[model samples]
Target: MQAVDQPERRATPTIRYFVRDLDAAVDFYRQLLGFEEELRPNPVFAMLYRGDLRLLLSVPGTYAGGHALPDGTLPSPGGWNRILLQVVDLDAAVEALRRAGVHFLDDRPSGVAVRQVLLEDPSGNPIELFEPATGYHERAR
Candidate 1:
């Protein structure tokens, strides 16, 4: 019998969102959030990165697995399943995004625990930017 060893993981994995229009999605994220393209699979595919987070975009028929949603068939308004981003300064982030012409749905401070701003991307995906309260730590189960 052979013994197997699992490799160690260093950092938290990133989430990838698929978009119908890769170029438009990439441009929106890069311009609105200061993320840069770290990789381009071709003219039709690209990976944008900000800090430790990553977003992959591709044109139709470019990626395998999950099928693409047809035009005009996306989820209805407020049907957004949001992606959360932890930032050091919530206000500054919101201001920058605002200056870039990004629409903000809400920018409210929730107690002293977090201040968050909700915004939607060109593809109607919602993203939440938040600042953690002081002395906060992730609890282990």
Candidate 2:
């Protein structure tokens, strides 16, 4: 009998979203998306996690050292870039979210190997939800 030593993985995937209203963003992610609030160290910031994904919600504009460029350009939300989340049932998920008053960019679920729906957070940050179908592929573990 032997026990093989393995290094513990500490680093996790993190995504920061500049939000208009921190509380609303927090609620949207926490309530609908299943993210658990991890930390709220300050008034303008919050950290949340769902599985291995760590989502950082931040209020843009001036603070102490602000998230602004040297030229005084403040960071803003809403962009084409998005985080993809896998779901078991795309139709059910979309229905539930829509019933909860969530917004979607595409009117219908569409994809080749996967059915997908692009949804927006309270601050308009895009998040893609996909359900793998026939011909879908993923790297072997």
Candidate 3:
């Protein structure tokens, strides 16, 4: 047991994804996932947030050039791998997305304990919606 003189440690922040177009990404995330714009550094970059999770959108030729995506490309390659969001109600989420004109490559699975649906955003980046089994929930680190 040492003396209580050291400062407390802070937890690391959550991972943030960078997208191609700031405005388009903002629009897509806002409409699709109900994400709100937490901050906008400039016209080139914006931060959209949902709870503790954050997404960063950067336009071409801004900040780190390598991080910016190609201009005029709806969904540029190598921008994103995939994003997965857990939902409390899979059916409602799926139905809502469907009504919003979102297309899914695979519809909601049938008779599965853990329901899942696969779809893409406006930029063609894939996203997976998951409703875990009754006893399972994702824990934050």
The CA lDDT at 19 in model 1 is 64
Instruction: Give me candidate 1's TM-score against the actual structure.
Output: 0.68
Residue-by-residue lDDT tens digits, candidate 2, 1-141:
559764587679888888888899999999898899999888799999989999888899846223789897998889999988888888999999999999999848887778899999999999999898754575322
Collision pairs in model 1: none
Error of 3 at 57 (Å): 1.4
Which clashing pairs does model 3 show?
none
Candidates in order have lDDT scores of 0.69, 0.86, 0.68
lDDT of 3 by residue, 57-81 (tens): 6654446332434553332423436
Once fitted onto the true fold, the runs of candidate 1 whose alpha carbons sit more than 4 angstroms away are: 1-7, 60-79, 135-141
Question: How high is each candidate's TM-score?
Answer: 0.68, 0.85, 0.67
Give lDDT tens digits, candidate 1, residues 1-80.
64966458665456556566667788888877767898886766687788777776655454422244676333222345
**Which lDDT value does model 3 have at 63?**
64
TM-score for predicted model 3 compared with the true structure: 0.67
